[model samples]
Target chain A: MSTIRIAQLSCGTEYSGVQFEIESAARAVGAKIVYPDVSYSQVKEALDRFGFKPKSTQLQLMIARAMSLADRKFEADAVFITTCFRCAEAALVRNELRRFIQENTRLPVVTYSFTERLKAAQLLTRMEALVTIVTRKELLARERQSGITAGIDSGSSTTKAVIMENNKIIGKDWTPSGAVVVETAEQVLANAMKEAGVEMKDIEAMGTTGYGRFTVGKHFNCKLIQEELTVNSKGAVWLANRQRGEATIIDIGGMDNKAITVRDGIPDNFTMGGICAGASGRFLQMTANRLKIDIQDLGAMAVKGNWANAKMNSYCSVFGIQDLVTSLGEGKKFEDVAAAACHSVAEQVYEQQLQEIDVRHPIIEVGGTSLISGLVKAVGEVLGEEPIVPPHSQYIGAVGGALLSSGFL
Target chain B: MKVFIDPPNSMVLFDLVERFGHEPLSSMAVIQEKIDNIEVDMPPMNVTLDDVVRGLKYAGVEVPSGIRGRMSLWGPMIEAADAAIIIDNAPFSFGCVGCDRSNELTKYLIHRRGIPALTVKYPTDEAEAKIMVGQIKDFLGGLKQ
Candidate 1:
């Protein structure tokens, strides 16, 4: 009954599934959609004014344009917008995009963080039922798409190998990060191909993404490679929609932690991890070991936990143990202590993140620690809500990796 | 060559100790809390080098001492090391040496000597790390371009 105006802006290199989901969600929501317009309009205009495209100039310039466009759109109940994924991952571009939006639009700015989808629920109509769309293999295998079209995602701590049969996920594999990216990529390619029950010969026109993708590509071979963000967004949208309704994705893995918002079931805005491991998987794992509990149980237990009054620990893993032990001796309950740990972790992440990421919707937690049910609850509590723990939470990254590798990204 | 391993409880320290010629002592920074999280060989991780003296004496950061001597610096206690072999599985670059220029220089020399420095932080991609390793290898390999 309402006509919501939505704009979906992504760099030319953004993943396909992410685009599709956004478009689809808008269609379902009856929102008038705009594409390729955000704070980056100036850069886009600047590009137009200079009579030079990205290839003619620096990659940074082009990245800036895309971010600007995204930021402008985010100003409107723009749902999800990305910020501070990393300084190295085209930050200036994103800043210009953000600056333009803050200067130009009257819309409330909302960062697409793990909190977005979990919080977007505040806007859901009481009468509208949650609509879930799970593609499984259909989107990944669309016959209309072909020609080594692909996406790649390489994390600092892990490598994901995905194979798509016409953009439909055919296989996926997750491998530990290697000192040499190319060597690991080769291993990923072999593993993904076998998992899809297919062979390397069957693949044509390969695309890749990730920090290691470049090195991996140099060693192995590929027809194309996409940005890691794009691949992750697309895969996340596809995977999230399969279960319940489309929402934002919170991927807290071993190394790279990300929060992707899917408005109308698409990637709107997202955020990623920085140098601090405070809210990261390794930190959680370390804390788990410190408590002598397994990482697997950390989440579920937190969800069931009672309150405790532990001191806020330092971000360092070494410091956290001492703080917790000291708190325990001081009579802090395990539940409160656990909650405090989770709070500090989330606080560490949100500290540098953009303000205004809605904290009331159904947040779909993904990545390695995303499997920790308690962490989700604890993080949600700190953010003022409870997040949705999905099935196949740990495999989401691998799933995304496969889809991108298969050309979906 | 020195290796700077964190979370002193790591097996990596022991592995480094066994593989390398060093006894891989824990960073006086905090062992126990000091144990390395890595999967290498190293010496026993004990003792926490803190700015306890500075915090109590001057309310600032200072250099942590090793079994060998008082590796003095300024500010809160700086972790002690000779050369460093960082093996962090996470991707973090926002580390600072505080105001203890002396100790900071010492740690820097250990890392700058360029033997093997590994560090881990989060939210970074694997490819990026690989590129760095590739560069380091290239430097070490000195494969004539």
Candidate 2:
């Protein structure tokens, strides 16, 4: 098969020196970044279409390139629109071109505002998502799991393996993240298979996901190695039995957080990243350590506490812990402090990440943090609706991999 | 050599460019000329409908007239620039070039002109300010007079 070409439409990439980072990100996913060619005449024609001439020739060229994509003049599987973060005109042009391309072409589109300090690491996930959309469209469209499949989620804090047969989870196992990612995956997969009373040869297909997906997938020769955004949403909606309609899936992970909106089981819009660990499960772990309670018990205690009595700062984790210590110093109840920590993380996720997606009914909260009743309560309270933390929510990535990979089998 | 400064009204960049031995094409000087000349437009309004029409050469008619007016004044400086210095993420107090469209267009033109241009983020603290100044100084020193 030919390489997928993602058309580059933007201004100031070379000036900002982020063009190399963008290229590096694209290359990492085995895809190529192509700048669509346009003639001077085509640029002039495109300027008329905008009903306003831009003073910058680069902006003019961007519009022309977007026009080329819209006219099917370029053979591209996806579109990436980028501009320097400081350029407001480029921002306007970027949004307009994004809308124009989406309206005119069947191609998937992603937009980013890059600074001079932009890195390949920052662009990798976006590039990967674009590549996934291009390469796994049919696979993503599959509605249900069929046949027996095994999936492993190699996460930052824990590794989870799940075995699914005909849309039902037959077996699952999870362990704290170990030193060797592949060994951890192998151990979890073996344990899960043992629980299912099935040998390796009985599994028709295998899939992997999460941060260590590539490493684990390569070692196991898995059929699908996918990013967690899509995988988690697939698993959350499947577990919640909300596969038919609009639903938002929120996964507060150990390192970061993801909020995705699904339409009929397919992710239409998603936002990931928490700007700080203060908004993720890591903070909860710290809270558990501070309270001298098992991580599992803190959640139940948090529900009984009044968050209003022991408010913590939502912006920084350090400040949050400081508040916790201050609250404890002031003789605030442990349950109240625990509740405050859960509420703080929930509020930060709402303020920072949840604003990116339009909130919908039956919000499905997944991930290891979802197992914490207090955190779930905090999310429900912050969102003003009780979220469904479906059974096996923590194994979402593994289940998503199993469900999606079942299509291949 | 003419040097164009983004936030075209920034007196700081204007003074720095002049101190570095380049003619700074400041929007203040250009607007001052327009304000002094009564033949083209009325007082306070500075630019006439003709200037706005001329601005169509730079931006689309769908864009606000404010952007077109600013573009008309800055476009020539961009076209004539031998080099440029753009300060990104500047506060509104730094130099209130209120029109985003014109600011973007000006920077784009300077970059597309293939001139020696130095783009720097606004320094948040004193240490970064020192570093930014050093960068600007080095870039200016390397420019061919």
Candidate 3:
């Protein structure tokens, strides 16, 4: 039995006290700890090289420093990213950092969120479990067996599924979540399995996440059930592995708008708008219908048109539609009205969720709404920076659910 | 009639009191006004050395210096109120000022004033919320009679 070396990555100022506790826990679990030695300048340079903007929050800078150091042959068995529970920025930065480390290096990363309410015994249990998983992965790497895992994200508007084989995404599919959630979950799973050319019996482990997770999990008899925030964070990092440093995830779903701050490849802080809020896909669809245009075309039209200063102030979907009609009646260009609506949705998210917190750069916009180019542009304009929309942003949640199962396996 | 509310700065209680046709008195409002009116910039709602000494003189009881200082802020508001509503277990957000000591001191001062007071825990569910609203309506309705 070789000594398990774990690289501990965290914000030094916030978790100096917890670092001692983490060291003690690792010692109890028969593992040695290694901290990052990279300076702020080194981290900033690394982030610039990776195409991320230079300016970042303190927590994000710290996460970048950890990633930069990790990239340089750290020689650790596993990586542990701990963040203060209330520090939303750290959580988001940690997620991005985790992805950067995993993509750049073969080291398995596990994130632990530390809060005042967290007990020493509970922390030790999680630490012990992470170590066990890391040690097992090391042994399994020698003779990797072909194992398939499936994950289903049964969201309010869409049911998505992804199939993974040998720790890689093999197939993914999604469909409208109309009426029956359980049926939608089953259909999406079947679609993904069909695409992967695999049978239901081939799946070794299965997981479920999102709004209808419990119902879908019960129906599918999933081995794991995780929350939307955790799965989505994991998925965003897994999908967007190239972008380095802290990435803020703005997931505008059909019924809700979720602003997730991803620090170091882990979701640190998140805020969601009220259900059926105007800052979501449903609102955008409604606005497109009112404009007598396709929802997909709305983005392109906004981008092509000249309405940089167009403002849509209403936070209510009904009021927003009324505003759009009023603008159209006032002889405003259809594209300008559409652009204003998209911009308003972004502003609503910033005002209701992202305004209070320290939001970082390289904002990654995800979800079905992110597929709209105009909405992405509007969000970028509102945030005062271009936002990154990963390929297949719509299915990232499902991809994350699959990765969670695959990582555990 | 003036009604003092516990968890003093709550907009929910303030709105409820107004709906019941009574003037709502909150120690938080008084503290805010004092802090805002100060010519020199100072920490909001903080008890100065002068405030502590003055508070001790008015408290007329032997208590911890900190408790006496906190009491001074709530004492006047409670003394001037005709009725009181105390909400326990209010769900405060992360980093929001929901100090337990301040809440206890405010409740104690309100009780000392000997006015009609209703103590209720913050509702955890819809059923509890309905009960809470009913309790408030009943309390205020009886005051009118």
Q: Which candidate is the best by lDDT?
A: 2
State candidate 3's TM-score. Answer: 0.49
Task: Write the residue-wise lDDT of candidate 1 on A1-409 in tens digits.
Answer: 3355444333422332244444454555455445443254465665543222323233335434444544452332443333223222222223334434434553322222122122223212100111111112233322233433323446676676666665456666766778877777677767777877876666665656666655655555764443444455556556555433446566776765666555444443445554367667777777677677776777665666553456865866668768878887887766666667776676565444422232226666666666676677766765566666655455454445445444433
Span of 10 residues, lowest total lDDT, candidate 1 chain A: A125-134
The i-RMS of candidate 3 is 22.9
| Top-scoring candidate (DockQ) | 2
- Which scores greater on DockQ, model 1 or model 2? 2
Candidate 2 chain A least-lDDT 10 residues: A350-359
Docking class of 2: incorrect
TM-score of each: 0.46, 0.67, 0.49
lDDT values for all models = 0.47, 0.83, 0.69
> Candidate 1 or 3, higher lDDT?
3
Kindly provide the TM-score of model 1 when superposed on the true structure, using C-alpha atoms: 0.46
DockQ of 1: 0.01
lDDT of 3 by residue, B20-82 (tens): 889888756777777877554557565574565445423322234565566566667788899
Candidate 2 — which residues are off by over 4 angstroms?
Answer: A36-75, A84-106, A358-362, B1-145
Off by over 4 Å in 1: A1-152, A166-170, A242-246, A263-268, A307-309, A315-318, A328-339, A351-361, A395-398, A401-409, B1-145
Two-way TM-score contest, 2 vs 3, winner? 2
